[model samples]
Target: MVLTGWASMLAVFAVEFLSLLYLGTLQDEAVMGAVGFGSMTQFTITSVCIGVTVGGAALVSRALGAGNLLRARTLAGASLVLMAGAALGAAAVFLAAIAPFTAAIGLEPDVRAHLLSYVLITTPFAVVMGIGMMLSNLLRASGRGRQSMWVLLAGTATVAVLDPIVIFVLDAGMQGIAWAGGVGRLATVALGGWLVFGKHRLVDWPGRRALLADLAAIGKIALPAALTALATPAAVIFTVSTYATFGPSVMAGATVVDRVLQLAYSLYFVLPGAIGPILGQNLGAGQWDRVKQTVRLTSRWALLYGLGVATLLAVFAPRVADLFQVAGPGRDLIIFFCRYGSFAWALNSLFFVAIAVFNNLGYAAYSTMIGWLRATLGTLPFVWLGAHYGGAVGVLLGQTLGFALFSVIAIAVCSRVLRSPPTTDATARVA
Candidate 1:
């Protein structure tokens, strides 16, 4: 499950890095900042979609473990509808607010315009991509991790093939990247829909009442899960906005480091999704010991992976900075993160693993609380002080300190939860 999830996430990251690399070659800091702003904004909007999927996956996996195929199918179908609706709603809200939001951020005119264009072209496709994500998560919950991986790979492959043609050959710039992303999402929906609806028959349309009930149940988890997902992006958006004050060079460098972090630490990002089903199914089967064991093992693996990746990143930090053609303060930011800030990911991995446990084992509200605390108390003050003291380098160091502190808190809370008696009624616990 981990391997497949890693591959799927790798493909997604590869396409993103490719886009960033192409933009870097243009030697345009505004474009780089625009991409960073646009992508993070889109991610913020889509976090709700992810939360819904996480909620649905937890329910579906539990149902399947209990041998309740009919319930699983209904939940899957209803959840997809719910996810699409949420995506559409989020996109609408984003489009309406983005203009004013960008203005408020005080971005350079060119960067602001590019950011708007990127979101405008790509926002409408959120529904398509949300559906694709729903299907992929459903596939994983149904014990078809390989098919889920393929669903993601399909989108990645489409983007890989079209990005160069659209961006370079057609000279579409930011608009080209948006168009390719839209097309890639379409490809994902195509493959994912077939797998979930046609081949596996994993989802079945539910009646109105059933749909409402399932939605309500899913929302019990999704609401908190959504908040949990939103916390990081919200912190990141703030960080980016803060970084912008330092000048476009710093913002551009921060963007490069952001992409490198996502690519290198893709495992941590994918770990929650990969472990969700394991934890959910075990919980459903009343296998408390297995659930506990899975969390322990996952935590260990996350730490090991983090340490190894950090070492590699530090070793090759300079080459990576050059690869993005980032120079000046931006280059310094990248190198600084590679050498010092990268170690923070080791702790962040533990926090993420704890999140999976909370989401899957019916303690989702814990995830929300921890996530917000990290985003607010753990992030804002530290980042402000870091920037105030160390400039851009301080910012990275501060964020790292925040992660380390929060990871310890998360692990403590997670351990307490595990020691408590297990609950079979995930929804009831949430209520």
Candidate 2:
């Protein structure tokens, strides 16, 4: 499951890297900055959908483990509806508020225009992507990881094939990239819908009462999970707004490094999603020892993977900077991260693992609190200090140090949670 999940995430990141690479060839710093803003904003907005999937995956897996297929199906269908609603609502709110938000952040006019165009073209597709993501999570919860993997792989392939044609041949630029993403998401939704609703028959229409009950159950986890998911992007948005003070060059560099980090550590990023079902099912079955073992093994693997990737990133940092064509302060920032700051992710992976545990085991508020703590107290002061002391490089260093500190705290809390007696009620376990 981990390997397939990693591959699927890798494909997604590969497409992102390729898209950025193509854009870098244009040699427009403002355009790169716009990509940065657009991507982060999209992530922040879609986080609600991600949270819904967390809730869906946890409850649906538990339902299956408890031998309640009907409950699982109902939860799956309800989750999709909830996720779609959240996606559309988020996109609409963002579009309506983006002008003032961007103006408040003092984004440069050119980058702001590009950002608006990208968001306008892509926001409507959030529903498609959200529904597809819910189906993928449902598939995983139902032990169809391979099918979920295929759904993402198919979308990745579509983007890879269409990106250049739309961006270059059609001269669509940033908007073209947005269109490619929307079309790719459409492809995934089509495949995922077929697999979940047709082949697997894992989703079903829920009656009014069942729908309300499912929503209540899902909201318990999803609301906190959504807040938890929002924290990272919120932090990034703040960081990006701060970075804008430095220059477009710095934004461009930070953007490339962001893509590289996602691509390099795709395994760590996917670990939570991959292991979520395992943890949920085991907890549902009251297999406390197995759950503990899974946590231990996952932590070990995360550490190993993080260390190995950090080393590779350090070794090839310069080449990566060159490939992205980020020069001056931006280039320096990327190299510094590669050589030093990247190592922080080794510890940060622990934080990710701990979040998975909290979300799946009915301690979701813990995840939310931890996330916001890191985003605010853990992030803002350190980032300010780093930027004040070291400029763009310091910002990266500060963020790394803050995340490392929180990773330790998260793991400590996770240890205590695991030692507590397991919850007996299945619904309460998720609740």
Q: What's the TM-score of every candidate structure? A: 0.97, 0.98
Please list the C-alpha lDDT of all candidates, in the order they appear.
0.88, 0.88
Please provide, for model 1 over 1-431, each residue's C-alpha lDDT reduced to its tens digit, 9 standing for 90 to 100: 87898899988998899989988878998889888888887787778898998889988998999999999999998899899889999889889988998899788888887788788889999889889889999999998999999999999999998888877899888788888999999999999999888898999989999999999988988889999999998888888888888877888898898899999889989888889988888877878899889889889988998999999999998999999888899999999999988988678888998999888887898999999999999889999999999998888888889978998899999999989545546535532
Sum up the clashes in candidate 2: 0
lDDT of 1 at 299: 91
- Those runs of model 1 whose alpha carbons end farther than 4 Å from true positions after fitting are 424-427
Count of clashes in candidate 1:
0
lDDT, candidate 2, 1-431, per-residue tens: 87888889999999999999988878988899889878887787778888998998888998999889988889988898889889889889888987799999888888888888878888888888888888888888899888899999888899999999977899778778888988999999899988987888998889999899999899899999999999998988888888888888998998987898889888887877889889989877879899899999999988998999999999998999999888999999889989998898679889989999999988898999999999998899999999999988889888889989998999999999998655655238593
Could you give me the TM-score of model 2 versus the true structure? Answer: 0.98
Report clash pairs, candidate 1: none
Q: How far in Å is the alpha carbon of 252 misplaced in model 1?
A: 1.0
Point out the worst 10-residue segment of candidate 1 by lDDT. 422-431
Per-candidate clashes come to 0, 0
